[model samples]
Target: MTTASTERTARTFETIGVIGLGTMGAGIAEVFARNGFTVVGVELTEEAVERGREHLAHSTGRAVSRGKMSEEQQAEILGRIGFATDLSALADADFVVEAVVESLEVKKDLFRRLDDIVRPDAILATNTSSLPVTEIATANTRPGRVVGVHFFNPAPVQNLVEIVRTVVAEPAVLADVEGLLGRVGKNPVVCGDKAGFIANTLLFGYLNHAVSMYEGRYATREDIDAAMRFGCGYPMGPLALLDLIGLDTAYEILETMYRQGRDRLHAPAPILKQMVTAGLLGRKSGRGFYTYERADSPVVVADDRTPSTDDLPELRHDIRTVGVVGTGTMAAGIVEVFAKSGYDVLYVGRSQDKVEGVRAAIARNFDKQIQRGRATEEQKTEVLGRLSGTMSLDDLARVEIVVEAIAEDLAIKTTLFENLDEICKPGTILATTTSSLPIISLATVTSRPQDVIGMHFFNPAPIMKLVEVVSTVATDDAVAETVRALCAKVGKVAVSCGDRAGFIVNALLFPYLNDAVKMLEAHYATADDIDTAMKQGCALPMGPFELLDVVGNDVSLAIQRELYLEFREPGFAPAPLLEHLVTAGYLGRKTQRGFRDYSAR
Candidate 1:
């Protein structure tokens, strides 16, 4: 191994060299130049060099147009970067980052050539997202000075940058690179050299699973995309994101990760290879999972796969009164939703006190809404007037629908369904708000299985707008339509899917969270570092660990276990570390501890 000096002093980097002038490379060069460093951008051919130059100008010009940077400043920034068609121009570069293609051999060849051109003290880095940095580093004589600086796309805007350190990397070299990234306004997350590192490893697995869902016709693409956006507050859906990232690029990354880790979850879905082969390469090609308006267009145009309103099942318009069971937060919110939407809501609890608690909860929520100018005193009174509380299931006999938001325990919920079946009228729609339990299992316990459906709602339902309308095999077409229409009437976005372990959101969510746990358990990276990688690197609303802590470790483990049982995929199994956390009674915020400590708060 080529070792660098073990000195602890910080190194000053003035000249930065970037090889390849593709989109990523150009963005990286702009980042360095904007940070006031002299940038030497090298490309193989003059045509490629001009493309890189135009990319920089267009990006900086947009900043000027947006008033983010003055034209004079943009010119100054452009002036700081100098382009060259030869590696000899980088002889004096203090730091060099290779942002070429994903091919290992090509990167190794570039590094070997750089060994003869650049100074021995200059730090070398690869911007490879999936290829092993260590193997690429080994091609050079000074392997100890080589590192991986994986920047997110649109590097000028994205804040997170992963600093991958191999076992042979010198400590000083790593520190200097991290310091340089920090100086350039990037959040640097350091981790051991591993394929996919942090973000892509967790992200692609979830994306691939979504592809598998789409391939199986588990749900319509629009519903699948809307579920994640509305249910989890994700900025974009998996399929849409896959389109933004070229399908071919995503496939190659998954393949590389799978080859290195041998983890089945990282294996690319078969459809991904097929899609790439068909030239359906997402936005660039105008088609992938969704058809774009044209090549390189962000606007999507309707195709044959788009659902038509003319074919929708007829909705039952007779749902005037709704019944909600349980006194929990979800039950109270559901009752509030129904009441506020002009439906008479009858809520049942274990006793009169618990039943009254539901009413009080709704009253408090309405008061807050009124305070926020979202409702009026008369509106609150009118909504409260529409709500009725009772301790007897027999009172639901006159209701048009009954939504069970009780405990997630299978036996407890099944027994409730059996009782609701006996008490409710013949045409009453019975819905369960179970997030993970099989809706079919609950349906089978009732005589009116055709009336049974899953109406899974996110927590704090009064604020959240998503309600997953899951239909079992036995669910009548009209019943699903009626519930879906009811959701629209109540101002909720309902995404339909077949009854399964997790429906859509949880099915796609928890596995990624479990993967984060596995990543932590393996000592690959710290929880905070992993969280930062996701939140900043991938533009996620929250990191997997932060979400897991908020969701409760026990709840997450239960959902993960259900997924494992239903799919029988080894990758679906709950991570042992998560199980241990749950076993220790570190449930979540309620218990004051989980993946993180809440007691301090």
Candidate 2:
């Protein structure tokens, strides 16, 4: 199976043999058969063979039902598949791909048998996501003939396939697998022999880190997941992704990668292993981090009646004036949000001019909301009347709480906290909205560290519901609870976490984006292909590259450096490509020319 001279060329693939017949295996067979290849689908037994055939039919049937494939096309694809219970059926296969179970012994044994049965020139490929392709290749008599074609789950739908080659693999063999993938409408990205290669190599590490955060009780699973989903625009949260990946399978993948790389971040969380022991293997087994209605179901039935806050004492209402600081978009948004909630706000900033601008911006924003019928004229007037900006530190002196959304420089923020500590009353809660900076460091500036917390808000704070209420080791339980209650009062989803760099969101997010850059740097695939694969194949809101551009490479580079410094792991070490881009002034869409050239547009 191969293509040449662009998509204009007709796909030319004759006989292709797909070993194993599970979900991934069946989908692989269907992909080839759909592209007009004579697919020899092989399994261990007649029952398994029939099951594989049914799986293929069901997959194509979905495409037809979804209007992605025509009925005639589905029938034609089914006609091309020939299922057998014997390996000898693949004697004439030009290419034989093994998508068997992820066990190395089982896969190695299958490849060894195939080495004896198939032609010497026949390309050998594996769809194993976590195992070493090199180890699988070494089991064959002609190891150079073996390569990896790691496909994402539901092979017929996902477009990306990682083409892994060992040290001894022939160049021609690598070309053949890439060609075959192209013919089957897949974008092949080449990588070295590594556990979780490319996608999972980067993806699972982040997922494991998220679990560690949850296990540490830094944040609730809901808020931690929400930070990534709403803040970063990920299609699903890390815990949900772990469920989709299968908790048992995710744990196994992390353990293997951790063993190989010896990176603590890749080390499987004990809780994940414990859950697996309890027979909660995620959606496949009907439970994991979350409960599902049934196996293979995504309809979550979370016990909303369950208590949300774990150890908070009963709330006492002693309401008073609140202060909102900073003159940026976020600060203005926050002002509007608090004012809308009927809180009298003393909006403080560096200067009167800046505060005036924030007021004007808030007015313009509310005007648009009124025009869109999202707000009533009376409500807008009442909300605006609640907000008043001031430059005097004395303005915050009378307030019960203050939220600072200043610039992200450590020196400047530390100085601001020091000033707040000296001026504000003893009971005033001081909070910072710093996203990636360590909140603990900010807490260190004040004697009342417990009173100082991280009140993180998603961008355009008035609209986004998620607000991460981060508490440092010294943060008072009372203060944390008060903020949590305040968040609910203002209609925000408040998730709590510790004072670590990136907290839950950026910690899991930036690494995935960095991995994409590394993938492109290594020439595994073009930026376009990787982006397409992620968007079309995984259903992510945006591909990593696109997201990097949106977040700005400088911001991403800063977060990456932070994670790298915190973990001190070689994999977490920021990719050289990112540094180069930053140094070259390619700061994403803000400056244009990131992974792609957006200057013209």
Candidate 3:
């Protein structure tokens, strides 16, 4: 959004040359010509040139059909483009941009040719997603004039363009490119020559981590995608996005990044290689992670793989009355969940003050929903009427299902389970909403170990749509099934898993967040840029630092620490900066500080 600084240029780029006539290249050429610049599109052959011409026609025709453009405008845009079948056609171009295959050798060969063929003073740019810009720049004779203009897919649509600068790039050349991109209605972010520049560097690490989770069979693809789409507000699940991106493309991106960074997080999962080898290239190949109706079709159909389903327990006790312990946000959210679902909910607290606190939390939750026109006064009254406060464990004896939403410590939860074991009726399902910690250890406290299970809910349970139903080795299938079914009754997507550290989301999420902290600690990029990269570059809900602040830095550090202890993998070690921040009591929004300042709020 800043004005481009003045820079020396041989002359303003009056005519543009675009190499390659693929989807990206064609769209980019269309963008230049649509803006009234004469563009020469070069492909290797006449057939490829015709295909490129048709691509432009199809795109502009669709825009006209959709009422986004007039027929005359589309015709004028087509008239501005002149197609050729050789690189020499660009000899007169003032600026030439290469949007060819991602192979380094291919790009190097093309750039070397472009350097010799195009006007010596013409600026050269590469639309590479992850290759080092310096390497590409060095292939040209005038390296000072080379830069990276990384554009997102559908160049005619996405506004972002990463303006990459190499050490040899002259300040004047950089400014000229910046001002040109700005004139084209682009939001350019400047960054140094790096493996992924600013965007892909932060994005691919997170995407690759999700692939690793899938490789480990930790969660079903559906649930993994659902957890993020529902839990984090991501536009799509990781696996689904991988399919849309093409597994082969993703494999190549990860391979390049891993070779350059050597960070474990960038390591491509073995499964990705296998699938790519099988020709499951993704939407282009008709299949990858999920089967689509046809090649390039968006409609997805159920494949041979069976979605994991839990059968409701036939002989389980009916959970007509429920008991929820704790007075924090999670506890109150659980209380609201049960109350709104027409169950008699008994919330237990230590003192009258604690009981009042829980009630206030629930009231505040409903008040906001009501203010937003999402809840009616009668509905709020009905929900509140089902909730009853209790100061004694004796009152919980009548409830059939007792779910404890206390702090994450095992000692506190085990103690609560021990008390509940003696108070609740026999065969009562004891569930813990623990993100981490062994459910079996909590279950072993009671004689009925088979009855205890983990029902991990994302924060703000009333709004978030995911609930992980975790089963310890000792837990009965009926207990897990009952909990999973209850999640459905309360309108949540319940994902079943084994009792493991981090369950599903946290196991996959925290490590990626930890890596982001490492990047920030290493001064790879600023927090705002990293966040923007993930949100705009990867279409994520929030950047890692923003999520860390909301999730609490202490909580994230603690989770990563637990993961390290359980796995003993060097990669799981909490980043030193994150550890020091937690140790300094900068626990995030609750404390008004962490990676960002929330003090003003």
Tens digit per residue, CA lDDT, model 2, 197-223: 777776777788788888887777777
Please name the candidate that would achieve the greatest lDDT relative to the true structure. Answer: 1
Candidate 1 vs candidate 3: the lDDT winner is 1
Candidate 2, superposed: residue stretches over 4 Å from native: 1-11, 61-74, 115-121, 138-145, 167-180, 291-321, 367-382, 422-426, 438-448, 514-538, 561-584, 593-597
**Strongest candidate by TM-score:** 1
TM-score of each: 0.97, 0.86, 0.92
Angstrom error of the Cα, residue 169, model 2: value is 4.7
lDDT of 3 at 258: 86
- In model 1, pairs of residues that clash are none
Q: Candidate 2 lDDT (Cα, whole model)?
A: 0.84
C-alpha lDDT of candidate 1 relative to the true structure: 0.93
Clashing residue pairs found in predicted model 2: 218-497
What tens-digit string does per-residue lDDT give for candidate 1 at 427-470? 89999999988889989988889999999989999889899999
Query: Each model's C-alpha lDDT?
Result: 0.93, 0.84, 0.86
Worst 10 residues of 3 by lDDT: 306-315
| Residue 10 error, candidate 3, Å | 12
What TM-score would you give candidate 2 relative to the actual structure? 0.86
